[model samples]
Target chain A: MMKGNTRGTEAADGKGSGPGRFLIRARADTNIQLGIICILIIILMTALQPRMFLSSYNFESMAFFMPELVLLSIAMMIAMLTGGIDLSIVGVANLAGIAAGTLFGFLAGEAGVGGLGTGAVILGVGVGLIVGVLAGLVNGLLISGLKITPILATLGTGQVFIGLCVVLTGGPAIVGFPSGWTWIGNGKIASIPVPFLLFVVLCVALALLLERTSFGLRLKLIGTNPKAAVFAGIRKGRMILWSYMLTGALAAMAGILLSARVNAAKSDYGSSYLLQAVLIAVLAGTNPAGGRGNVLGVALAVAALTLLATGLQMMRVSNHLIDFVWGAFLIAVIALNSLSARKGL
Target chain B: MRVLRNSNVVIALILVAAMVVIGLINPAFWQLSNIFSLLKANVVIGLMALGVLLIMISGGIDVSFTAFAIAAMYLVVRTMVAIDYDGVILPFIFATAIGGLLGLMNAGIIHKFHMIPLIVTLGTASLVRGLVLGGVGTSNVNIDEMPPSLIELGRANIVTLERANGTTFGLTAMILVYAALAILIHLVLTRTMIGRSVYAYGADPEAARRVGFKTGRTMIFVYCTAGALAGFAGLLHSSMSWLANPRGFVGLELDVIAAVVLGGCSIFGGRGSVIGTVLGVFILVMIQNSLILMGIDMTWQRVVVGGVLISAVAITALRDRRSPA
Candidate 1:
């Protein structure tokens, strides 16, 4: 890993006469642009609803919604970095939630109130994580071992996961978790939401993983140019598999949190989040074609979009129109980015 | 010998095997009436599959067709109801033209930006669906006001079979329409100059461009044609089901794409056929129908379809690896 870092810095310095200068400058530009977008959204939203938008209650609610979007966006960013996509993230999340919810139901029974125990929560969460990992493993095997295109492979597997969820619950929401389970989703630590704290911890961990580890560097190399990475003696398939697995695990964590927050699990829960996750990742400057990403950009993008959504809801805009705005926003952002890239900006 | 290695041949074999297995499980599946009804039920999907095949062959994809279809169909239906118009041709024209216009929107953006078709279409799909849902509101246009001609055309049968138990089965005008469209598309894809260019471009866009192929125009043509077909499918669906709900055809892209891919169309583009898509549609519809006949739960249908998609691609990939194409 140290050798890899030196090699990267040498290439940067050889061309630009400084170690990390060009890369850091480019990243700083992206961060600055994203920061501006965030501040602009805040100002615009606050202007629209001077009192409600800036209220502490609004912030708390936004905090509640931000974790799942943040986690899903991060998962999507990782997959995009590998020049692949996991369309199955939503499916994986729902499946993991359902698995955990079912475990809760089994331990607590239909009433789900008196049997609340800490052990049951731990067991349910464990089951959810394992299911998520297994789902990821299947996706990894299909993409790496069978040589399937990531998009189509995940699309198919996503359907299968959703189908499994539907079959398990018979097309109805599963509600019956012990009250203790809510702590992960709804409880607070030091006046901050637990889910938000978890989001921060995971984001920091992911940043460290991507920046400080050999695996992350290799994954990026593979994404940038597979042939070049292969020439450099990296095992491309293994890295791709690991990247997808990591995404699947993250998706499961989001799912578990969602189930805990809502106190119910269903196949269709967070179906809308699928496209939103992609939207957030792309907006955060995760190149859809792969090879470039930043955690800070993703975090800021999530904040901006969440603010936009919450503001629209407060203004009484229909949910469907909000979806339209998201779609239009994605296209506009991508077009602008492409135009700038073409101009070599 | 060459036919044995053909991907179409492989798909045909799979379809035949599936049919045989289903037939063995429930011999009623072999009934001509059941088959015709099945074909009729899947005609909308079949038509959409043709458009998808064209896009795939031309090196792009449009998952937004379902949204376009529903939007066009709803517009036509709502207009007809508001004016109390009964003409069939006008509705069909309105639907197809609206669909084509939407496709043109997609083509314009994709061409200008040179974006990935999948992501572009994904965004457009959301935009289109959102516009319809938000603008039109979530309400079903009831069939009480449907034109007599449309309903009659929907029910018009080419042939009928009388059974011992008073049950009857036959092919509808819609099925014939589907067959005609399939044949027409097949001919156009195989015989026309534009079709050849589409194939050439799909095989290698840069090389085709260097050779002076009008890649942009061909892309527009492909997407517009797809949108028109989807519009037609949407109208057919409403005519058959007797309502045009804003939510109609939501998530139907998955079925259409799965069918086209199962028909041996390469997702990477430049490889597929109209006949292969027809066979693929049959295989999917058959699985669905057979599952119902066997009293299997409806949820399992998705699992089966998803499984088929994965296995088909996996098998093709394995074969490609062995041959090193």
Candidate 2:
């Protein structure tokens, strides 16, 4: 592992509450703000539809839907930690799912439609994970290796990945993941959905990795101050490359959950999730410039947005309007963060 | 080697080389009719690209222009249908004005709050597109409902060509509009005070501010002009296609931006010529249109475009690193 200056490494100390501000200023601690926002959304939803918003069924459904989004958001957050973004996350997710689903269909053949044996599902997942890492490696190569800007490199690769998906599927959905694979996305244990449990375990593990591990520390320090990190003998390029690989792997996990839940994979599925993930990451207080964010904030944001979206849909709002609301919500948070920051200044 | 230092020459050389190679492989590429069609195809994208060029020169990026274009086109056509109005100029003006207004929103947020243009535009893209589809209406304006004069305006041609095989391809006069705007932008950037300020600001905002340039005004002008251009391009598109879909140009920002960059405009702001951008747009347009003519799979279009963009950007990035500012 690359080590930074022992003294200046405090910036990469992985503080849940830190001074890396994306907007005008982030003084009130993002977690608290996100917590408040989540509570407010819940209160509003409950007030608007008491029975529907509070039902166990609603929570379960949201649990099933929220994991993929949460996973993607956290993936986005970590990329942000390097002061770089992975716009290719959506493309990676879709591609990973396509690879995995294709594997499933190939293995299952004609007679094995009901469910695949455990081994095939595991192998398929491994394939997906490898594809995700490869995609990320390509991104890292373009951004870090070729010295291209992250946004442009990722943007280009995203198109390539999406086009590959299109060419692979020939413009149709790939269906029929075995029941065993689907169980990871749908089944429950002790009244808790499998997806939600996985989400919890994975996110908490990520938090620990980011907070306690030196690998994650090097990444944040790279984001906080590239020159300083370089002076501190950090392997910046290798670290960034590995970080994107990690990011891709996380996106793949999200893709797997999504494909399992929907019982299919396609190039065009979850097109809108890209914008929402960006929105949630920003809302989670993940500074766009990097070095400040945590899993807790992202989790709260995911919960809030999911509830907000579900409640709005329950009110019979158009999906486009919900998108508008989310956009407005993002801008509103940005403005408020800035305005309050100005006051602090 | 010295000439290669100028990216304009580099881009122009690439464009010519591509044309020669493609024309060699498929002689149909150099046909006058095909060339004119490519020109016509470039008009809308060219206009949008010019606006984006200006913003790039001012050190900002906008992804919301496509949304702006669609909104302006949809809202104007919807209003035209409702009022039973059928005229080219009015819709043109309305679209441009609506686009300008939305551009003002972007400019305001960015200049006032000092926010990044990408995020600001992303928000507006969602907000504006959603507003149009959700709040206004999602149903498209049918051709029959469209104003006849607008359609006629789009159909106007400066010259008509009849091929040996009996196919007719008239060069749309919209190319004239595009050319006039491109020339105007060139003149403004080279000859006007505001344009110089835009370049200056993009080169270094702090230094420009120190030099007493109206940094805020320049930013506003750049975004607003970009918006207006996008608006006009939108109406032109609908007129050309003879329909209005609120969801059209959904992901065109990538193509337009790629074209602008491919043209030699620096994404980091400043240091790009209008001619460079024009050549860049033509190269991209040629690449896109030639694929169909060359019988390549349409699905490969994205991959090819993306590949071209990456290589182009990589070349620029590596060269810049070698001789960085």
What lDDT does candidate 2 reach at residue A249? 93
Q: lDDT (0-100) at residue A284 of candidate 1?
A: 80
DockQ of each: 0.44, 0.47
On DockQ, the candidate that comes out on top is 2
User: Which 10 consecutive positions of candidate 2 chain A have the poorest summed lDDT?
Assistant: A1-10
Tens-digit per-residue lDDT, A123-205, candidate 1:
88889889888888899999888877777789899999998999889899988577777788899989999999999999999
Badly placed stretches (over 4 Å) of model 1 are: A1-21, A109-114, B165-168, B322-325
Q: What is the TM-score of chain A alone in each candidate?
A: 0.92, 0.91
* Candidate 2: tens digits of C-alpha lDDT, residues B64-102: 999999999999999988999977777888899999999
CAPRI class assigned to model 1: acceptable
* Residue runs of model 2 more than 4 Å from their true location after superposition: A1-28, A109-115, B165-167
Q: Candidate 2, residues A1-345: lDDT per residue as tens digits? A: 111111112322233224445321442467777788788988998999999999999999999999999999998988888877778898889888899877776777887656678888889789999999999999998878987777778888888888888877877988888888889889999989999999999999998998789988888778777787899999999998998999999999999999989988998888888888888887887766666667888999999899889999999999999889877877887676556655654
Clash list (residue pairs), candidate 1: none
